[model samples]
Target: MTDLNKLSLAEARDALRDGDVTSVELTEACLKAIDAADVLNAFVHKTPEIALERAKAADERIKAGDAPAMCGLPIGIKDLFCTKGVPSQAASKILDGFKPEYESTVSQQLADAGAVMLGKLNMDEFAMGSSNETSVYGNVVNPWRRGNDDAQLTPGGSSGGSASAVAADLCLAATGTDTGGSIRQPAAFTGITGIKPTYGRCSRWGIVAFASSLDQAGPMTKNVRDAAIMLEAMCGHDPKDSTSAELAVPNFEAMLTGDIKGKKIGIPKEYRMDGMPAEIEKLWADGAEMLRDAGAEIVDISLPHTKYALPAYYVIAPAEASSNLARYDGVRYGRRAQLAQGDGITEMYEKTRAEGFGHEVQRRVMVGTYVLSAGFYDAYYNRARKVRTLIKKDFEDVFAAGVDAILTPATPSAAFGLGEMTEADPVQMYLNDVFTVTVNLAGLPGISVPAGLDGQGLPLGLQLIGRPWEEGDLLNTAYALENAAGFVAKPGKWW
Candidate 1:
């Protein structure tokens, strides 16, 4: 069999069901690819023993004719997910050596579906940065490069490693969490499909918190079909998480009819930012045209509050991050700094935090604390919350007007060289999520599909925003876009 690692999740699932391959064989293929691709720094942890054991069990289940859609599929878990007995650090030093005794609800759900866990993928420290530079495990190099240029590019953040691993065929698919474009941005950078389901679509029970309200787990895969399949396996209501939606998980994979005729796709005017690159602008127009050719009506819509999405996200996310990250004061688990003579409890807390958190994490925590302070609470945090409400309402009004999905550029540009933007003003980096944060703010389902290549020969993606609880319809629309774009280009295997 040719490289089983290169097969998409849906293809592998069909092969496994037809008895054309064994789980061990597929797992070995991924393990071999991962071992040879360490230059990417995607897989932070290697779990060969656990992977082989699970693959063996999956083979048995397949033989017994009881395999699920994700059965025997090898996948990478983001570091933010707490896997039982496996290092689950959120790419932060504070969580060093912190392996949970229990599994995260999403991973547990995948395990129950017989998906084999390959290892933990790298991410931004506590999912803070957009470039993945804040990761304690170091930067995840993008597999794609500018034409004939050897400069290493970032795979985009928080979910950078997951994007890289899937794009490089190190694994069939991986789990990614989006707070502010964490999943969609990385997927766009690496030319994969990533969808952030409606808030509470997947249980957040054991995942590390970045911003509780905005953070959500979703699947990053090679195509829309694979995304649909993996998403079905990853979603379900969990009593353990109060925020989880108490609704039935639909058969997303089966919903991919690719016939989106009469679907009203909105083109929001606010996304057409000033001085936007000609390539991104052209790509957005091409995407709208493609959807129009696919029989969907392209309507121009107004989301007047789009300009405030980034500022609101920065404020709200950090504010929640400040409150959620207060647990790591050397009081419970994970790393603890050694104390000096006469050091009191307060000193320990300060010293431990200063040492454990990275620069970006510290900056966000400080900003969060400042916004939540008594004097500035109303000026910053409260006002941002009100803006978030308007953003949500903007989407509601559009949907109420019969817009089925909205189209926009996934990122302002294609992936940039590593360290190119890190040293610049931090706001430059936050702008990476300009087109993506609005979907998260509205708690709606959004997907990024590889659309076309930029002038540099790097991949660019088109995003589709759908109504809440309509991921099935969203995936079907993404499937239509994927088919129209015909984005089969892969990174030239530099890693």
Candidate 2:
């Protein structure tokens, strides 16, 4: 049973195929693991009834010789994705009692692939904060760390719960959406592998809108192979989402060569910020050395627009967030507040939203409103868009200059104390995304793979980024580094 938790999705599928284990047995094992790890707050909802039923169906199909690629695998769904019968709150009080009539396209696709639905995982309210503390259900503890004291650790957000669950083996692999580093950051913090594909590769049809132009759904898993399998199943075109690309979906799993020979990896000079921890720096350097040993050339390159990326991302993401969040006015969806004397529906909406949103959420809404307001639109939003263009242009130039991909540190440092940045000024939290936000702005693919552990016994992640629609190359490079680093640390077993 314990070995089931350590098996990759492919291995589990083979075990089921070979009749060494049944879907029912695997699901029960995961359920037991979840029950034992409930203190971590990794799950917001556990649909055991639904999960078992699906597992039974999968087992029957496998017995009938109709097994699919991901048949019978239990997977975690992030709370942000709308589930048909589950409350999809995005972990915010404003969304209390809200349920969608439709299942998100990616979720539907996963179901079509025969993956069992474990439950919805926790996340920061409305995907607003870097740490999970902003979740109304409370923070998700790092499963790699023990104890209940919130200050001892943090699960990176807004996809922190998904990361935590996957890291702790609560689920095989999970779905994650990235607007500005949400998936990649948390995956880095939790010492797991997550990929943010090129924008438009995955459908965002029923995903809760954050920054519409930037929101993308991707996979979070224990290794590149499982991630590749999930990504292949999750990606497709949806006519409902106008931005969903009409390109051909590749066989991601079949393409894993584990060979990235002769690839030109560009080390972006500007990403090495001054305050970056020495451990993170060494991880990046070591990653370069690993690639060099794999017969890939490492070239030092510059992304001059990087200095302006975080500022531009903050302005644009918030501006879009402010506009998208207007739907939660209490009349159509989400919670409604009681009116005070002389207050009507307008006042009710104002109070409900004000009381429902967390600090970081409210801050972004205010910034969004201010930037999109009549007097500031041109000065703030427009300028930010122009800078975004420049950042994209920077990547195009580098890729054109014989760079197959770029390599850098996934996060500035390893996971910090849970409360370390919660009470901090917003800018400090914003800066934590410095190394990652630019890739989203450019509509490119990026991934985080565990590189090594830091001096503090925390995990450090090395990031590999690819040009648009080049997830094949991105995953190949990551697999190469994964082999070289050979760093896999499991959370302490308490069961």
Candidate 3:
């Protein structure tokens, strides 16, 4: 049999249903691959025992003919998600040793669908960084290197581990959260598929808070079909999360007819940033041509608020983060500092926070606190909120004008070497989300499909942003682009 670990989620599901492979066999294969790929630092916590037990149960379900679409599939849960009794640290020291007593809504739904939990994947601390360097588990090394060079690259973040694991075939698919491009950017960098459904598509109850309004959970998978399948399993209404939508979930996989003829795909003129790399420009043009060849009408559209997305996001996300993250006071759970004899409760709080949180988390928290402060609330946070409304309106107006989806480059460039951007200004690092944050700000469903390679042979992706609550349309469009691009390149195994 071919490598079970290398099988896509859809293929594995079909194979399992046909009795060609047991869930245990598939789970073992992923566990073996994960054990050997430790250099990538992708799976921060291994749960082989739970995986095997769940796999056995899944096998029984398959035999009983009670299987769902995700039955018997081995998938990694992002650490941001709370899996009962599992260490879900959110890759932040502040959350060190924190294990939830209940599973996150999305993970529980996957579990209910008979998906086997392989383990928890790594991520940037509090989902704060773009390059995954801010992860307390060090950095998740991108499986794809630049040509023959030995330099280590990032898998993008804060969903870096999900991207790395899926790209490396460590797991068939993994859960990921997007707040300002976490899912799509990493998927683009690692040559995988990731989708962030419209806000409230997936319940955020058990996921660690980043930017409450901006945080969304989605699937990171090997292809568009797998993304659709896993996304369906991960989405639904949850009364636990007030923001979760009450709408019914669709059979996203069934919607992938890939017949995008006469579909109006918008190409936003504002996405053409000054001094953008020639390769990215060429890749965008090539993607548009491919879609055009596939009979999609590529039309230029304007999202005039594009330029303010990053700044507004930086302000708004940090502000919400400041409010949401106030719960980690050391008095509750996770890490607490060892106070000196003279230290009081106030000192303990200060010391615990100082020791527990990472630099990036602290920086964002400070920024958030500053923006939400009494004197600066209107000047910064409220102003950014108004800008966010304008940004949302920009997409609403475009979509109302008969555009089915908007196509653009997923990221500014391919995966860069680790520590390369960290050495530059932090704003340079934030610029990585320039092409992606607008989707989050506007609360729309967006997907990244690996479209082509860069000059150095690393992968580049094209993003398709669909109308609100229209992930099926977005995934089908992505499927069309996937067929047109025929991007079957996998990173050479180095880990």
lDDT of 1 by residue, 406-455 (tens): 99999999999998995559999999999999988999999999999999
For candidate 2, write residues 19-112 as lDDT tens digits: 9998888888888788888888999888888899999999999999998788899999999999998899999999898889999999999998
Which residue runs of candidate 1 sit more than 4 Å off their true CA positions? none
Candidate 1: 10-residue stretch with minimal lDDT:
419-428
List residue ranges in candidate 3 displaced over 4 A. Answer: none
lDDT against the true structure, each candidate: 0.95, 0.88, 0.95
* Candidate 2 segments whose C-alpha is farther than 4 A from its true place: 146-151
Which prediction has more favorable lDDT, 2 or 3?
3
Q: What is every candidate's alpha-carbon RMSD to the true fold?
A: 0.6, 1.7, 0.7
In order of listing, the candidates' clash counts read 0, 0, 0
Q: Residues 1-495, candidate 3, lDDT per residue (tens digit)?
A: 679999999999999999999999999999999999999999999999999999999999999999999999999999999999999999988888998999999999999999999999999999999989988889999999999999999999999999999999999999999999999999999999999999999999999999999999999999999999999999999999999999999999999999999999999999999989999999899999999999999999999999999999999999889888889999989999999999999998899989988888999999999999999999999999999999999999999999999999999999999989864589999999999999999999999999999989999999999999999999999999999999999999877
Angstrom error of the Cα, residue 275, model 2: value is 1.9
